[model samples]
Target: MTDHNQAIRDDIAFMRSLAEAGRQAPLKGGSILMAAGLIYAACAFATWFAASYPVSPLFMPTLWFGGTGLFFVALFALRRRMGAKTETNRAAGLIWAGAGWALFVIVLSLMLMGYRANGWWIMAAICPIVLATYGAAWTVAGILTQAGWMRGVGFGAFAMALVCAWYGLEVRTLFLIYGVSLLGLVALPGYLAMRQAQRAAA
Candidate 1:
């Protein structure tokens, strides 16, 4: 009986240590997310301005493509600076990366469909989809970290998606609102993550 109790205690202690280590692991790739949010925010703003005030036919697409390109460049640079990742960070990174790829494929497909359909009404759906994707990502992160604030942010993102859809009839309004949403949903959380990582390193 004594030996069995000791074994059970050792197993519990081992699980506790694993949980503690996971809690302490700092999430990396915040800078990449922050840069993506800021870059796309600028793109959305520029596209809004172009729509409000007429610009060259090629201007909006060019701006968006350039912004995406810039983000990739920034991603490469920031990723190189990152040190070795813990299992926690690796899991978080995979989730975000998958979300990013999903968004990329969805957005491009929408763009192509819009072009083929010869109607841009489909473009209005992009903001809501983007926000919802962010919501899912944040929700998963919250589950992994067991953080209430992250979960709140995730639910808040879902609400924001509905808000964007409500105002999505107008391209200009949608772009403006989405830019703000990116600031709050993507940029702010990313900044907070960066701060947390910095403090952890310290």
Candidate 2:
């Protein structure tokens, strides 16, 4: 019985050590958020321009897909440059990655189901989905890091999502709001995280 108890205690200690190590790991440089924000903003602008001008429908798809491709390529390069991730970092990455994939699947499914029939509703739904993803990831990160500010950010994201849903704004206006949200929620938080890491290192 004593031996078993000792083993359990040892396991607990090991887990604690791992958690501590994770907490000490260097923060993400926020490149992903910055890149995503810029890409999203650019896409929004391009979409608006296409609608305002006599541009072909094909142009919008090309711009969006091309911009997405570029963003992924940049993300890959950034990850490679960052080298190996710690356990906590990997956990965080998985959360955001899963959210992104879910968003893609949701959007694709909606498009496939004839979005033209309910274009306005579809557009409004997209914003909440995005904001929810951001909120979930940020909230989880905040819990892990014990960062009060991050929790506030996560709540703020959810609030924004609610506003988007309630207003059911037009696509062009929604895109503009989304761009601003990305800057505030993703880019700004990422910048702060990087700065915090730098200060810790210094």
Candidate 3:
């Protein structure tokens, strides 16, 4: 076949594989519902954590969690699409996805603990690590998936955290709160929902 015809064939095969995969799954509608739950948890936690430290400057934490909410919202929506389509091509996506959450946890820990540093020092230390883990996961999701948005939100969170550090925000302990509000509430559950569907579809 010609290259263009071959490409079309490949797309058709991909879709057919998905249809076959979707036939043997547990839950379909719940992915989006679960995402909704996760988002709620994140918002509630963010509110709680932010209130506890009314006087502290957790500007980064605020932005981080806020960005987190958006990311999860997008992720959940994306999951709904994939799950509703045929089979969720989530097997590879799930593997890398776990690593992404792990890195987020680590970054938030450091950020909340008030370890803000100077110059390229922070990026040199943290950025690569975060990128390495999250990037791997996003790559598995493929360029066409929601990986780009997740990567973008993650980078935004990191940048905001760096700025917060520069201004000397009190990040200690608050990182836990931020993590709770952000990942636990958002990414973790969102990851779980999609992963659950992904694995089922796989």
Candidate 4:
């Protein structure tokens, strides 16, 4: 069988084991937050569409959008807090890796200023550098929690980075699309899938 099919089977087996062990408790918190993200995306798109004005995804929206993601992160922590355990070390690895990326962002913002020749170049680099750092975190987190779905997300991020380099979009446009599309599109769904998988295992 192809590796993809094998991986799916393994994931299924893991879920079955969880179910058999009665660890499966539905995590509605993650689901509710994801649904909220979709709702917000729909509202944003509609608002932008009706107004005939492009909405710049700004800092406030980022805080709200990022807060939604943080909600899921809390769900993961809560699950573990409530006695959930990962058979693989991937979860722990991913957590530490996430921390690494957060630190990288702080450092990068401080250091990269004035280092790059053009302001647009700096903007383009931000997405990829952040995402690559994030991928590095997932890589260190352990392989089980780090799956192909995440690889795809990383690639999406890398693609965004390339686009940033090629097109040099305004920071506002980049923020809007990245938050509404990348996080909303890639990170949010990946988070939901993880939660769903955990739920099924329960």
Candidate 5:
């Protein structure tokens, strides 16, 4: 009976240690966001130029689809380089992944809607929607990690969404704003998160 009680205590202590370790470990997978931000920002700028100038209509679709392809390639590479994962990292990854899928589905639906309606203005809504999705993702991460800065990022995303919407009439300007926003909101934060994770691991 004494042995049995001691064994139970040992299990409890081990579980507690794991929980503590996870709590201390920094979040991972920031590289994915960083890559996504940079790639899409360039895509946005290119699209803006395409719209402004007398570029081929094929340019816009090619640029965005190609940018997405590059993002996925980077995604795979970053995932492999992330090394071992912790519970917190796994949770954070899941949150971001779901957000990504949600955005994909939304974009596809909007595309379909544009095709059916024979009007592309509906596509303009994608800008605010994307930012809103990011806001939700960042907010969830903040809640999970108990990080105040992450929540602030979430708020910033929401605000940016409004800004994008306000400038929605000027499609060219909107793309420029979106590219800048991605750099400030997504790329910078992603870099910071990567640095923090590295420091924590060290």
Candidate 6:
């Protein structure tokens, strides 16, 4: 009986230690946000330019896929360098990573199905779906960290998604909206979160 009680106590203490470490772990350092934001923004601008010019349609696919690949590489590098894979970090990473995978599958499936035949409406619909994923990621991060501002960012992203949907079919407008949304919803809040993490570490 004594040994059993002591084992239970040991387990409790180990769990508590993990919880504390999770609290101290900086789940996001803004690197992912900055990298992804810049990639998407560049893709948007490039797509807009392609539409305005006589560029081949191939440019769009190349730019989108190449930039996304670069972002993923950067994200992996940042995570390896940070080496803060606490439970909280893992949870947050899973949420965003899952969203990323879902987005990829949806986009790929759309492309494979020749959804582009529907004109810009299909692309416009994609923007809302992407934004909703962003909102979900931020909201989950906010809940995990108990950060009100993060939740606000999530909501703001959702609102922007709706606005983007409303302004449909204009290539330039859609790209511009998406670019700005990345900055406001992802990059800025990520910067703040990074700063908060730094302060907590200090």
Best by lDDT: 5
What's the distance in Å from true for residue 58, model 2?
Answer: 1.7
What's each prediction's TM-score?
Answer: 0.88, 0.80, 0.36, 0.47, 0.87, 0.82
lDDT of each: 0.84, 0.73, 0.48, 0.48, 0.85, 0.76
Please state every model's RMSD to the true fold in angstroms.
5.2, 3.9, 10.9, 9.4, 5.8, 5.1
Query: What tens digits encode model 1's per-residue C-alpha lDDT throughout 75-177?
Result: 9999999888876677778999999999999989988998999977887888999999999988877666656677787898899999989988888888999
lDDT accuracy of residue 68 in candidate 6 = 84
Candidate 2 per-residue lDDT, tens place, 1-202, comes to: 9999999999888656545755686456467766776777678666655655687657856886798899889888877766566666776777778887998898677665645676535545777778878898888777655577877989999998887677555666676677678788887887787777667657
Q: What would the per-residue lDDT of candidate 6 be over residues 66-158, giving only the tens digit for each residue? A: 998898889889777665566767777788889989999988876766555755346556777888889999987777665677789899989
* Candidates 1 and 5, the one with greater TM-score: 1
lDDT of 3 by residue, 36-149 (tens): 335544554554466466545556456556757785776667665753433344554455456757867876666645355533234223433543443344343333233344
After superposition, candidate 6 runs with Cα above 4 Å error: 1-26, 115-121
Clashing pairs in 5: none
The TM-score ranking, best first, is: 1, 5, 6, 2, 4, 3
Candidate 3 to truth, TM? 0.36
Worst 10 residues of 6 by lDDT: 112-121
**Winner by lDDT between candidate 6 and candidate 4:** 6
Which ten-residue region of model 4 has the weakest summed lDDT? Answer: 21-30
Cα RMSD of predicted structure 2: 3.9
* Root-mean-square deviation of Cα positions for candidate 4 versus the true structure, in angstroms: 9.4
lDDT of 5 by residue, 1-202 (tens): 9999999999888656545555687678888888988998898888788776797767767887899999999999999999998766677788899999999999889989988999877888888999899998888777666678988999999999999999988889999999998888788888888998889878
Better of 2 and 5 by lDDT: 5
Model 1 CA lDDT for position 145: 63
